[model samples]
Target: MTWAVLLALAGAFCLALGSALQERDAIRAPGASVARIGFLWHLVRRPRWLAGSLAAAAGVCLHLAALSAAPLTIVQPLGVSGLLFAIVLSALFTRRRVRLGQLLAGLAVMAGLAGLVTLFPHSADSPVLPIPVALALTGCVTAVGAAGYLAAHWLPAGARAVLLAVLGGAALGTTSALARVVAARAAADPVSVLDWLTLLAVAVAVFGGLLQQNAYRTGHFAAAYATLLVVDPVVGAGIGVLVLGERVPTTPFDQVLAAGAALLAIAGTAVLARARNRNPEALRPASSPSTDLVHTTPGESS
Candidate 1:
């Protein structure tokens, strides 16, 4: 169990570091190309982003292993530590002094999300959504993602990053719900996984991943990452309650606390977005104009 906890923590760290590494390369990529799908073509050639992807994949595997070893009540809350990990990793990679506000904001996000999930005390069992519910969720994700992508062009870089992250997170959450359904059915009927629900989940997951990349390209790492973390579980919890028939019923007081936690997470994301002017470039933008990843030696300047 102790090893499981350690692995969970390690998974969080890997995820945070992976995002930081990916952002480092994304920022240095051509903004003009990044604004389009072409940036992926350009980014795939970068060693750093590939390494980041591998790290993220490893994190997911580790997290799954931890979940198999531990309970959801313990594992889910530990996920919040990823936000704190992101703060530390970003500061270390950027070689910037950690600002009080950034640290506090990260804690706020972590605490808010931790509180929000801990209130539920969910079980490890997977509750699959019905096909109709899965399709509806997919439609909602599609609509929201399309709208956010269109609106993103008009917003400032920081705000754009947060918006895209939220969209991506929501879509991914929906994918998770649908995935449970698909997996359960696939186990009983191996060929049944080729249904519409599985297709929808795959589509939403792909679109969500693209949205995540767009968020990174905006170069507001903390705000975007925190927002994504907040929205993903929030959306998942919402589906669990509203769609899954509240297997773990909450009291009215619990609902209020959950709302408060959501607000705190939002506030923290705003603080990160509006980084102190004195350290204007610290959280404001991720990478410098120079493509340091290309010229600088390895282990020098994230």
Candidate 2:
């Protein structure tokens, strides 16, 4: 594997590690501050959160550097490794088990992602979008993210997880897009240190971190993670094709196979979400069904 691919994989591992640490912290705090606020505060005091954040920062830095060398297609597929890393780390650290369905679903998603990555070329040519266009795109992304954030908060935990996942996914997609722009600029014309991209990179990393933490806090880890994982690649890949003008690998057969894989992933997530919804643990289950439990029967009272 190329250094760029290695760096991208490392970034994914950092993200996975950070998320697992955050989840560990969440389990400890009863009535934890909502994931967003709690994660921000945790970053202030907790050594683990700090370590995780620093790791994430390192990952982002590496990713930025990798973007300098590789295409979004190559870089983005490597990100799916984050979910794998998270699952493995979670099992090692917490002994938390993932369901069979979730595992299969994850595999499906990764397979599709890998296929997509292989199908696209790794050229460094980035489209020269006008500043206004970039700004407009950023605005749209932020608006959608904000709307999802609001919706997550408004709904109960399950729904909240779904919405937060959407937000996290979008945040990631935008981050990757920004990374491409930076890479392209660097590739096309030598730019100085700390340019427009430097600022956007920081924003994307921080915001994505915050929102992703919220995703963990809003609901069960499996469902939230699956949703976020699914959405991020789809969005990123879509942008890569539409905005970056990357060519998809040819052959109708590959396209059909990729679509099937995507469908399996989506179907798996939908099943997981619905199962979570039906399970009593996801919500505040009703109290005892027996009305008489609170008061003695008439005969007993007498």
Candidate 3:
């Protein structure tokens, strides 16, 4: 259990820092919109985005390992604590000072995570969904993603950020739920990791990440990142309950405690998100237009 907690925190750190790096580089990618495949084509070629991708990939591995060792509910909340790491990383990169509000909010997030880990006693449950159910879920995810992507274009900037982030977080959360099942199956049979469900999960994660990139492009990191963190766990928690037969604390005292912890975490997430937004350095792009196009990427001229 201790190892699982450590792994989850480490994964969260990598993910937060990697996302910051990737978003910083992405904003510099020669475009205002992330709708075109050409936008991402340029990002992959950049050295920093590639490094960030590697870090985020490592985060996924660590997160999966933590999921295999503990319940989805237990491990997911800790991911929220990544906001602190993001704050520090943003400060370091932008050369800005961290403010008092951000510090307090970060502590609140940590307290909630500590409470959640201490209260939750459920171990991981092996996921087993019927074939029809899996297909239906897959179809729903695809349809929603398609719809959301189109809808984002029609909406205003602020609304677009929220919509994309919510959809992206939900997709990633669904991936986490599927990963739990895949991880469990892997322990029983290594070859089973390549099954249909596993493939679907991988696909969904990629789709989610693409949406996330679009959200970051909106230049509203607070709305996008905070929404992503909050929605991801909520979606995963729902799936864990509906499909995996997971539940929250049944005892009255524990239930109260859990509710309080959730509130604290949510509040902290919002506060930290707003703080990042106000800080000049959160995800600022390159000052020079020429530097933005310095790299000879795909379909691009240096």
RMSD to the true structure for each prediction, in A, is 5.9, 8.9, 5.8
Q: How far in Å is the alpha carbon of 259 misplaced in model 2?
A: 2.0
RMSD of 2: 8.9
lDDT of 1 by residue, 1-302 (tens): 99889989999988988988887777666433124545566677889999998998888888988999998768877877888888777767767677888889989988888888787756546566777777777887899789877777767666777888999899888877777667778888889888888889888987887788778766578888898898888787778777865554358898788778878888988998877412223233334433522232121111
Q: Clashes in model 3: which pairs?
A: none
Residue 72 displacement in candidate 2 (angstroms): 8.8
Once superposed on the true structure, which residue ranges of model 2 sit more than 4 Å away at CA?
1-14, 26-42, 57-81, 187-193, 249-251, 271-302
TM match of model 2 to true structure: 0.72
Residue 286 error, candidate 3, Å: 10
**Which window of 10 residues has the lowest lDDT sum in candidate 2?**
293-302
TM-score of each: 0.85, 0.72, 0.76
lDDT of 3 at 264: 84
lDDT of each: 0.75, 0.63, 0.72
Q: If ranked by TM-score, best first, what sequence of candidates would result?
A: 1, 3, 2
Per residue, candidate 3 scores C-alpha lDDT tens digits across 1-302 of 99999999999899888887886766666644435545566778889999988898898789989989987667877766777787677667656677777768777866775576456555555768765777787678778988987766666555666788889988998898888788888999999888898888988888887888877766555456766776776687777777788876779999799779878867876665455344243234434434343332221110
True-structure RMSD for candidate 3:
5.8
Q: Which of the predicted structures, 1 or 2, would earn the higher lDDT when compared with the native? A: 1
Leading candidate by TM-score: 1
